[model samples]
Target chain A: MNAQYRHSQPGYLMILIGVILLVVAAFVWVYGLQPLEIILGAIGIFLLAFGYKLTVEIKNGFLRFWFGLGIFWKKIAIEQIVYCEPFRGVFAGWGIRFVWNGWLYNVSGMKAVTVVLKSGKKIHIGTDEPVQLIEAINSVLHGQVGVESTQMWSEVKADYLKRVEQALSVARHPRSFEILADVGNHLDRRFTELEPRQQTWENFQRIITEMGPPSEYAELVNEDKKSGRLKLTKLEMSAIGVLLVVFGVSAYFYPQMPERIVTQWGFHGQPSSYMPKPVGMFGTPVIFAVLVIALIVIPRTASVSVNIEGFRRFYGGLLIVFSIVMLAVQYQIILWNLGIKTNPNVVGIISVSAIIVWMAFRFYRARRHN
Target chain B: MNLENWQTQLRKGLLDIVVLNLLNRGPSHGYEMVQTMKRIDGLAIREGNIYPVLARLQTDGLVTSYSEPSTDGPPRKYFKLTEAGQKALEDMNKHWDQLISSLESIRKGTGL
Candidate 1:
């Protein structure tokens, strides 16, 4: 089969900006840490994730384009494209902005292939090779390309579907229908790609042989389904319990504590924000508990496509980290009330940095695994 | 020292150049490229693996693809070399020629 072709234009400028922000954040952190450093670091990460590059791909008759990690993307069907031409006009600033009539998706440079869709919308795709990109689009619009006969696919498709259904029946998983549909789609694409002479039952059998036995596929699907079921492990539940205990202990100190509690501190380790005795003592713990509970429940209740089970350990670790940080803050608050002076700002900075480092490590490992 | 391993590594290393040289002739699809590679003995390139190579090439801005709608089945994606790809191929060809000549001279005992 003709697989997808992809071209990516690196947003050197955006990447540089991200790098600069990160460097500045690091410098600020080293000199005097503030919430602004965290904000800058966050924006740096966001830019790196979503503004680093622009990629355009020709796949399955769609002209798919995206900017950085596919966070922002658009797809246009080839059939919708009336024509495309090499664009030469006034230079517009880059990174997905509204042009004269339509939108312009560019990472760098003024050279682009402006595609005119059937609905009179024009999309200018920035590319270094504007002429070649236009030529590629034109060839697809006008060229005579070889295609497998639908008649040939029709001959074996029924049998193929039947076999696939039979193969899926043994699994008895709840997601069997979804799996069947996915397998059917894959087989359809595979069958369409086969040469006319190879579009026979015999060749299909050979292909199936290469794909392995039905039992193996069923076993795989069953295993995947089994592993992916969402449930809180003992460790995760224990972490939540520990958090509750920490909050409970903090409540124990309420009677002995002062009228107003130091809930927030400034960069100079001085108390900057305070709350009334009741709200200051219990408010943060209550908010943190609610946040942790929401974090635990959202993935299970929400319609997230990702298999949360895969990140069960990571998620558990995160909850533990949150609990530990909460414990430290609660302890510091108690100490402050008991006339023990401690820098809560330092504690906050350390906790936040630790979490950031752990997350970065996790992200790096996930990328390496993929 | 393992001849088979050496041959495999050599072929793998040369895949980019080989693919670029193939596309330099004319535009071709993934299957066509794989079929052509299969004809070259010892290349042993798998059909599934060619797409990644093509994708990487495209990502590098050396090649670009567009789909031609098939009369019968799905649209066929065709990849062609860009100007950068052409220049890359020329540079690789020159380097390959130099390497071959150097090896030939050594084989013939024509050392300085």
Candidate 2:
């Protein structure tokens, strides 16, 4: 009902919506490097927190648009929009998505809506589909043709009043406001969902891929050119990037290539039986590869599953174990190749002792202090 | 695999072509794209991959997105071919074909 101020930068809202997905994904993937998770998660939350804006416009007669990040967006022309209903959520991943024609669309803090488009494509706009918007489209598409300006003005006034009431309500009961704020957030998100009035396949993949993940439900998040998340896709990609870099560097400087592969076992290089296999130290990158693989394989998402955090833990644990194993293997081989005989037990104990102690310290800090 | 070195970039390049060609069929969602990518090859694309190339295309205005609901859940951002994206794919395909021919020549010379 109120006149919503148009935002100058929808990009902010887009980035904000994106970060929320990442934080949720990180919380779920809880299987990677602690420092990396927190570092990335913090950045994500920051962008999202500052990214709220309003800039939905319908330039052509063909579409009605609402845009934002955190929520989902579904478009239906007035003719095709079969019904706009306030209903329970669908697309119930971590949260429920809005709907129209039995399809998932967007999610705000908590509401959902479904719409049937003129083209017969069904869409689930957000539940928080600004009622004022519904009326505008209803009148516009069906032709408010000659509805008195008074009715439109009154509608705008009514919406403004609702916004005012919500603001006052927040001031009165801060805690309840927090809950409502969550609800309001759902609405804010709903706005972002419309960032691209047209969420084509290219758009969806593009945005979601940028989010970085091992999310169990990467598919749930949408990407359409305008903007979205790609955490899980990016994670795999970054790994691929690393692999390419490793191989590329190896190819570029063949001599720098490490002779051994590290895993749960230390510097485990097999002899090619050509020239006393060079006593090369391949420990670091080998361990890095193991860590990368573990993290990527641990599926996660901020949607239905809260896996990022768990995934990080799983991957981190794997990395820690692999690192220790590789370290021992590396040291033992160094001794062997040098013609020095160190007792297996002595080498193993000496190499693993420090890591074991460090891990214990990490455990105590993670559980209690950190 | 000699592919080891250029794999990521090669894969990234291939991703551009795959997404555009698939969208040419009709608008599709992120999941649909990944599944189709798998059907094509030793292509080795993960479910989590290519979302970026889609993003890059969009950033460059070669593609656009819109949401549609499915019986399953949340709205999916459906991708369709944009004129610019289609043109880019055509160019990529030409170069790819030429590159294959050049590599074939190398294979023949080696006579293995």
Candidate 2 lDDT, A1-370, residue by residue in tens: 4322112223443475567767665764454322234435554554454334323333344333333442322223344443333333334221212121133423233443334343333344333444545555455554644233323322332343244333333223212212222222222222234333333444444433432232311221123411322244444565556555554543454344334522122222222221223324443456567666656654332222222333444445545555454545555545544545554444445544544565455434322310
Q: How would the docking of model 1 be graded?
A: incorrect
Per-residue alpha-carbon lDDT of model 1 for A50-154, expressed as tens digits?
Answer: 778888788777888787988557778787675566553367457654443345678777777777654434577888777666656655664533222333343
Q: Which stretches of model 1 miss by more than 4 angstroms?
A: A1-230, A303-305, A311-314, B1-112
Model 2 residue A150 CA deviation (Å) reads 48
lDDT of each: 0.64, 0.44
Error of 2 at B91 (Å): 1.2
Q: Each candidate's DockQ score against the native complex? A: 0.02, 0.02
Consecutive 10-residue window with the lowest summed lDDT within model 2 chain A: A92-101
Query: TM-scores for chain B, in order?
Result: 0.91, 0.80
Comparing to the true complex, what docking class would candidate 2 get?
incorrect
For model 2 chain B, the run of ten residues with the poorest summed lDDT: B46-55
Q: Which pairs in model 1 have colliding backbones?
A: none
